[model samples]
Target chain A: MVISPSKAAARIRAAAVDAFASAGYGGTTTRDIAARLDMSPAAMYPHYRSKEELLFAISFEGHTEALKVVEGADRPGEEPSVRLQELVSTFASWQAGHHSLARVVQYELTALTPEHYRTVVALRRSTTRVVREVVDAGVQSGDFTIPDAEGVTLALMSLCVDVCRWFPAGNYTNPEDIGKLYGDLALRMVGAA
Target chain B: MVISPSKAAARIRAAAVDAFASAGYGGTTTRDIAARLDMSPAAMYPHYRSKEELLFAISFEGHTEALKVVEGADRPGEEPSVRLQELVSTFASWQAGHHSLARVVQYELTALTPEHYRTVVALRRSTTRVVREVVDAGVQSGDFTIPDAEGVTLALMSLCVDVCRWFPAGNYTNPEDIGKLYGDLALRMVGAA
Candidate 1:
C-alpha cells in the first residue's frame, strides 16, 4: 500500500497523461486524474498542485526525453547523410513508440503556463537545433544538396514530429519499420549523394 | 442580427473552431462557443444539437475542402513530378493559409461521433488517394523513383498535414513559401529524375 514519494508522483503523471490524452488538458480536471489513480486530490496535491503543473511536468519530461533521443542519435563524425538518417529514424520511431504520451506532449503546449511554455520551447528548439546542425554539416560537406538548411531542417523536424499523429495506421504499424522507412526517406529528402 | 440560417451556421462553425483551437474539443463547451457570438445556446441548438455536432461540421467541411484542393491540383496529363509539385505546394500552403481551422480539423478528429469520424476519414482517404496516384504515376512513368508508393504517399500527407502545427514560424511565414519548399521536398522524396 505504501509507495515511495517519487514513485507516487510518477504514477500520478502516468495517470494524468492518459486522462489528458483522452479528454485533453482543458477537458480533464485534477479530480479526474486523481480518480484514475484512485487517490484523493489531497493526496495528489503534493506532487502536482494544479492541472497546469501536471501538464508542465509532462511537457518538460517529454521534451527533455525527445531532446535526449535526438542528441543520442547524432554521430558528429559520421557522414551528414548517415547522421540525418540516424536522427530522423530514431526520432520518428520514438514518436511512434510513445505516441499517446507524445500526442499530449506535442499538442498541449498552449495549455502550459507562459514560463513553463518557454522552458519547454527551449527544449524543443534544442531538439531542432541538433537537426539543423546535422543539416548544415551536410550542406557544408556537400553530402546533401538542399536550397536552404533552415527550411530543410524545419521539414525534417516536421516529418518526425508528425509520426505521433498517424502512427500504427495502414501498413505502417511497427515503430522499427517506420524508423527504417523514414531513414531511407530522410536521405532522399536531403538529396544524399 | 438578420443573418440567413446558413450564414448564422457558418459564423457559429467559425467561432467554434477558434474555441476548439484554443481550448481543444474536450475543453470547449457549446455555451462558450455561443457566448463568443453573443448568441444564447438555445439559438445555436437548431444548427448544432451538441458540441460534437459542431466538431463534426468543422471536420466535415475541412476534409471536404482539403479533398477538393488535392483533386483540383492533380494534373493527370502532366508528368508525375510536375503533378506532385503542384499537389504538395498547393496542399502544404493551403494547410498553412488555413492553419487555425486546419489545426482544429486535423487534431480534433477523436472528438467526433463514430459515424462522423468515418465520414471525415473517407474524405481524408480521397485526398491521400490523389497523392498516391500521383506517386504511382511518377514511378510507372519513370519520372520518379521510390521504395514504395504507399509509404511515400503517407509521408507526403504527414508532411503537409503537419504544416498547421508550426506554420508561420522561423521565417517560413508565407504560405506560398511553404508550398514551394514542400513541392521541392516532394520531388526529392520521390527521387525525381
Candidate 2:
C-alpha cells in the first residue's frame, strides 16, 4: 500500500531525528535525511522546508508524546505523593525507551534558528506548565512543601532528560531501576508531605 | 625568541578548544585550529600526530582538569551537607567559566574511538569515585541515609552535567544558587539527618 501523507511526514521526521541526534544539528544536512530514506533531498521539501524545521517538528512531537504519557499515568484519586511518584517514574522509563528523540529534543535546542528555538522553548514552557499544575495541586492539598516550584521542575526535568546521555541501548542501568530511583528522588525533592 | 614549546602547545590547545567547542569534534579540522593560531597546519604537526591525536590530547587535559575541580572542592572537616553544597556550587561555576572546554568535553565523547573512549571513561570513573567517597563518608557518619550510594552519585552527576545545556553567558544561574537548590534537594532525596 502507498504511504499516506501523514505517514510520509512521520518518516521524514523520524529520519531527521536520527540524523540530528546522531550528528549534532550543525553537522547534518537535509540531504543526509533524504539519503537515509533513499529519496532525493528535494523530495523531502514538500514535507519539511528545511532540516531545522523537521528537527523542531520531531521535538514537538516528542514533547506531546511525553505529555500523553504523563496524562495516561495519572491516577484519578490517589494521594498527591503517589501520583507524583507514578508520573516521574513513568517519565524516566519513557525517556529511556525513546532516548533518541529525547536526545535531539533536549540537546539540540541551541542549533535551532532564533524563531524555531523560541517555538521549542514554548513547547518546553507548556510541559513546564503541566508539571507546575501538578505541583501546585500537591501544594494546595497540603501534600508538599516546596517553596520554589520552578527549581523543583528543573530538578525533575534534569533527572528525566539526562537519562538519554547514559541510558542508551544495552546499557547495564535498566530503565525500571532508574525510574524507581528518579521517582523517589523527585518526591523527596519537593518534601512531599 | 620563538615561543617556548609549552607556550606553543597551550596556544594550539586553546585554538583547538575554541574550534571543537564551536564546530564539534568530528566537524573540526586541524587546519581550522592552525588558522586560529596564525600558523599552517603542517607547522603544528610536531606536537600532535593527527587531528584525532590533538583531540585526544585536549580530551585528556580536560579530563584531568575536571578531577582537580572535584577534588579541590571537597574540603575536609566541613559538614557533609556543607561540603556537598560547596562541591556542586563550585562545579556549576567551573562549568560556566570553562563553558568552551566543558562543552567540548561533555558533548564530543561520541567521537572518540573505542580505545579512546575507554581512556576517557576511566577518567570519568575517577570523578565518580570521588563523589562516591564523599557519599560513603556521609553515610558512615550518619549524615546522609542513601539506600544506594552509587545511584545517588549518578543522579547528582546528571543534575550538574545538564547545567551546560541551559546556562548562557553572564545571566546563567549562579553556581551558589544551583548548589543551594541541588544540595537541599539532594539531602532531602537521601533522607539526610
Candidate 3:
C-alpha cells in the first residue's frame, strides 16, 4: 500500500503533537517525530520545514480549536450570567478533554519562532477578548459583582487553563465534571450569587 | 579575584534558574548557564553533575521555599477564613514576587530525573496538604460553604499558581495586589461571603 504525501504529513503532525506534548518542544526532535511515524527525518522535511514549524502548526491549530470552543458558547441575546457559565464550562471542558494538545498549545509558546509566536499570541488574544467581554457583560448586568472585570476575567481563565496541568483522566471523573465544577466556581469567583 | 567553587556553584544555580525560567528547561543548556556565570562548561561540572542536575536543584529549592511560605502562613488557633486568607496571600505573593524562580519550579518538573522528581513532588504535597487542611477547617467551622473541598482547593491553587505564569513584573500594581485579589477570590470561591 502506498501512502500519499498528505497522509504522511497528517501522520507526522499527529506524532509531532504527541511527542511535543509529552517531552516538550525543546526535548522533542524531528528524528523522534519521524521515528514515531516510521519515516525518515528527511521525509519529514517535505511536510514541515523544521521542528519549530511543526510546533507552530500544532500551536496554531490548538488555539484555532480553542477559539471555536469559546465562540460556540457565545449565544446571541443570552443572559450575561448564563453566557459566562456556558463560556467557562465549555472552554474549561475543552481544556480538560483535550489536555495533551492543550498543554503544548498553552505551555510551549516560548518555543515558537518570533513571527509564529506573535501569530499564536494574537489568536490567544481573541480568546481572551471573548472571555473578557462575557465578564464585562455580567458586571454591567449586575449579575456579577466584580470589582475589577479584567482581574476577575484573568482569574477565571487561569482557573480554566490550569485544568490541563493537573486533571487526572483515569483516576477521577471526566472533563464534564471539571467543566461543571469550574463553571460553578467561576460564578462564585465573580460574585454571581 | 578568585571565585570559590561554592560561590561559583551558587552563581551557576542562579543563572540556571533565570535561564530556565526565560528559555525553559529543554531550551536552556549548561553552556548558557556557564556563560552567564563566566565559567566554562568544564568548570561547571565540578559543581553540578549536569544541566538536569542544575534544573533539579532550582526546582528542589523553589519547592522548599514554597513549603516554608505555606507553613509560615499557618497560625495556630486562627480562624480558617483568616488562616486561608493569610495562606493564600503569602503564597500567591511569593509566586508573583519570585515568579522567575516559581516558573522554573512549577513548569520544569518534567525535566527532572525520576528520583529528583519524586523529591519535588513530595514537597509539593506538603503545600497541598496545608492548603487542603485550611479549606477543610473552613468547611467544618461553617465559615466556608464548599461542595467539594478537594475541588475547591484545586481551583484556589490553580488561581494562585497561575500568577507566576502571566503576572508581568512591571505591570499593574505589584505582587501584593495579586495576593490580595486571589485571597479575596478564594474567599468568594468557597462562599465565605
Candidate 4:
C-alpha cells in the first residue's frame, strides 16, 4: 500500500500519457488516469496538482524529446545539402517512431491550458526555426532555392506532422523507408537536386 | 415554434459541425449544440435521436462535400497529369475555404461511431484510389515514371491534408499554393519533369 513519491509520480505520468494520447486531453479524466496507474487520486495529487498538470508534463516530455532528437542529429559546419538531408531524415524517422508522443506535442495544442499552450507553441516555433535555418543555408549556398523559405519550412514541418497522423509504424515497419522518400522529396522541393 | 423536422435537423447539423470543428467532437455536447442553435435540449431531440446521430450527420456532410470536390473536378481523357493538377487544386481550395468542416472530416475519425467510422474510411479509400488512378495512368502513359504509385498517392494526399492543417488563408493567400507545388512536385518526383 506504500509507494515511493518518485516511483508513484513516474507511474502517474506514464498512465497520464497513455490516457491523454489514447483518449486525448479533453476526453481524459484525472480519475481515469489514476485508475490506469492503479493509484489513488489523493496520492496523484502530491505529484500533479490536477489533470492539466499531468497534460503539461506529458506535453513537456514530448517537446524535450523532440528537441534532443533534432539537436543530437544536426551537426555544425556540415555541407548544406548533406546536412539538410540529415536533418529531414532524422526528423521523419523520429516522427514516424515517436508518433504518439509527437501527436501529443503537435495535434493536442488546442487542449492545453492557455499558459501551457503558449509554452508548447514557443517550443514548436523553436524547432521550426531550426528547419528554417537549414533551408536558408541551403538556399544561400546555391544548393537549394525554395521560393519561400518560411513557407518551405511550414511545408516540411507539415509533412512531418502529417506523418504523425497517418504513418502506421507496424504497417510501415521501417522508418527509413518513409524518411528517405520524404528526404529526397524535400531536397528536390528545395532545389537541392 | 413549429418548424419542419428537416429544417430542425439541418440546424442541428450546422450547429454540430461548428461545435465539432472548434471544440472537437469529444469536447462538444448536445447542450452546447442546442445553445448554438438557440434551442433547448427538449426541442432538439425530436430532430435527432442522440448526439452520435448529429455528429454522424455532420461528418457525413463533410465527407459528401469532399467527394463532390474531388469528383466534380475530374474529367477523363484530358491527360492524367492535368486531371491530377485539377484535382489537387480543387481539393486544396475547398479545404482552405471550408477549414472548420474539413477539420471535422479529416482529423476526427475516432470521434465517429463504429459504423459511421467505417463509412468515412471507405470514402477516404475511394478518394485515394482516384488519386492512384491518376498516378497509375500517368506512369503508363510515360507522363510519370513513379516506381511506386501508392507512395506517390500518399505523398499527394499528405500534401492536401497538410494544407488543411497549416494553410493560413490570410498570409499564404496564394490560392492552391501548396496544392500546385505538390502537384508539380509529385510529377517531378515521378520523373514527369
Best candidate, TM-score? 1
lDDT of 2 by residue, B6-73 (tens): 88988898888888777666567788889998899888989876877777778888888888898888
lDDT of 3 by residue, B78-149 (tens): 888888888898998898898888887887787788999999989988998899999998888899998798
Per-residue lDDT of candidate 1, residues A1-193 (tens digit) = 8799999989999999999888888899999999998899999999989999999998899999999999999999888888899999999999999999999999999998899999999999999999999988988888889987889889989999999999888889999988998999989888899
- What is the C-alpha local distance difference test score of candidate 3? 0.84
Point out where model 3 deviates above 4 Å: A2-6, A169-173, B2-5, B169-173
The model with the greater lDDT, 1 or 2, is: 1
Q: Backbone collision count in every prediction? A: 0, 0, 0, 0
**Stretches of model 1 off by over 4 angstroms after superposition:** none
Least accurate 10 contiguous residues by lDDT in model 2 chain B: B167-176
Candidate 1 chain A, poorest ten consecutive residues by summed lDDT: A140-149
lDDT of 3 by residue, A11-75 (tens): 88889888877777777789999999888898788889898898888889889999988998998
List, residue by residue over A64-100, the lDDT tens digit for candidate 4.
7777777777766897777777878888888888777
Q: Candidate 2 regions off by >4 Å?
A: A71-78, A168-172, B76-79, B168-172
The candidates' DockQ values read 0.87, 0.50, 0.61, 0.48
Regarding DockQ, does 3 or 4 come out ahead? 3
Better candidate number, 1 or 4, judged by DockQ: 1
| TM-score, cand. 1 | 0.99
**If ranked by TM-score, best first, what sequence of candidates would result?**
1, 3, 4, 2
* Candidate 1 structure lDDT: 0.93
- Per-prediction fnat: 0.83, 0.46, 0.50, 0.25
Worst 10 residues of 3 chain B by lDDT: B164-173
Candidate 2 clashing pairs? Answer: none
- Point to the candidate with the largest lDDT: 1
**Per-model C-alpha RMSD:** 0.8, 3.0, 2.0, 2.5
Chain A (alone) TM-scores for all candidate structures: 0.98, 0.88, 0.94, 0.91
